[model samples]
Target: MTTLFFDLDGTVSNNFQGISRCLNFALEQLGLRQLTDLEVLPFVGPPFRESLPRAFPGIDTEAALKLYRERYATSGWLENSLYDGMAHAISTLHSQGFAIALCTSKPRVFAERIIEHFDLAPYFKGVHGPELDGKFDRKTELLAHLVEHYKVAPENALMIGDRDKDVEAALHVGAHSLGVLWGFGSRKELLEAGAKHIVDRPDELVHTIASIA
Candidate 1:
């Protein structure tokens, strides 16, 4: 079976509004200026540890993350919704005997909760993500751990996501990557990051997967 690794935010779920609200809330708590939706769009897929520091220099990342989590867990996370046709795509892939799993930069606890909340837990074999301590914050590390722990061969594996990090992570492990255009990242970003294939929507995802898998 073809082993598929999917990114959570932007790829499977549209959680931008919730994520932005929580991030802006955290910034507010830190006495920093709140960002508009456009300003927060780039932060969707990357780890907060890196994005927070870069967006707000000299800020206390740990404290800001803590505040963000506090808001996210209560209401922000629930504000998310599955992308149109994503559920159908996941089910189709699973029924076709693909070994599907989630590999996201979001914290493991939060990822699990989001999947469960959306009733998507049945579609995946495993859900892998970083810890709250930020150990697996990088997509490279997260993908490496998923491949190693699950014994997925790099050549047979495919990473599907919406950002450059996903493409970079797959390349780091000698795996192929498929970038989705419906997400936050642009075509230029995915191409520059060396994505093996790019699809425009969830309906196109299955066709792209079949071509490679």
Candidate 2:
């Protein structure tokens, strides 16, 4: 493929600790019951707007979002760490001449900060994500915008992510997808979402991308 779109949360870095902690912080602020990290795992890959409402069932998502970001911006963002071999995989691909960028459901500013925190800023061409105001919240919309803005053919791009939404977004825009088992998603979940290729570890990422692309 000429271009590669990588998902942030689960694929590139293991941000579960940060995400779950922030989620609980928001819940505690709302005087709601806090969830364990494992309980919060399902919400990691999806937008917080969707997850908050579903978790609380009739709470103000906007308020929860504000609280989540309040904590995320300060300490939660720094809680993340790169997946084993992810740096190697990304650098290897960049050296091979594939254009790489981040495609995440996170707000652009937050995603940018996380990239910089991980010292991964130089390897990426751009960060594609929604605004804090919730524009382009859907994966399909974001992917479509990235494709048009970058002048990339859908078929010539491969989206690599750890969740089904990533595969769905790629399919919606007619691009290829590779699902990673190292993240939160299970094998059946990715296959059911129509991901054609799957890799079990970060070390296998480069070869898997080469095969799919």
Candidate 3:
């Protein structure tokens, strides 16, 4: 069977509002200036440590992550909704016996909670993510771990996500990469990162995956 690895933020879940709010909350608490919604887009895919320092110079990554988590656990996590048609697409793929798994850079704890909250837990065979301490924060590391633990062959696997990192990670693991346009990353960025396929909508994703599988 073909294995499908999905990214949580931007791809399956539209948690932009919650993520932006929590990030600004962290910055505010740290006595730093807040970022606009557009300005916060780049923070969606990568680990907090990498994104935080770039957004706020001289900030303490650990403290910022702690504050973001504290606020996210309480309210920010709930401030999210599934992207349109994403549920249906996932259900259809699962019904068709695809080995679906979540491969996100977000902390595993948060990824699990978010998936459960959106009732998406049943659709996935596995939910893999980084540790709370930020170990395996890179997409390549996370993807490598998932592929090994599940014994999935790279040629039989596909990675679907919204960021360049996702595309690069798939390339690193010798898997196919599909970039989604409805997410944070731009089409140009996805192309630059060497995405093999690009889909504009959830229905398109279903079609693309069907064609490949």
Model 3: residues with Cα > 4 Å off, grouped in runs? none
TM-score-sorted candidate list, best first: 1, 2, 3
Better of 1 and 3 by TM-score: 1
Write model 1 residue lDDT over 1-213, tens digit each, in one string. 379999998899989989999999999999999999899987899998999889889999999999999999899989898999999999999999999999999998999999998898998998989999988999999898888988988999999999999999999999999999988999999999998699999999888899887
Q: What is the TM-score of each candidate against the true structure?
A: 0.98, 0.98, 0.97
Compared with the true structure, what per-residue lDDT tens digits does model 2 show for residues 1-213?
A: 899999998899988888889989998999999898678988988887887777789998999999999999999989899998999999999999999999999889989998988888899999878999999898889999999989999999999999999999999999999999988999999999998899999989888788877
Supply the TM-score for candidate 2: 0.98
Model 2 / residue 136 / CA error / Å: 1.5
In model 2, the clashing pairs are: none
Alpha carbon lDDT of each predicted model:
0.92, 0.91, 0.91
Task: Tell me how far the alpha carbon of residue 27 in candidate 3 is from the true structure, in angstroms, after superposition.
Answer: 0.6
Q: What lDDT tens digits, residue by residue, belong to model 3 across residues 14-115? A: 889899999999999999999999899889998888988887788999999999999998999888889999999999999988999999998888889999
Q: What's the alpha carbon RMSD for model 1?
A: 0.8
**Candidate 1: C-alpha lDDT:** 0.92
Q: Report residue 150 deviation for candidate 1 (angstroms).
A: 1.1
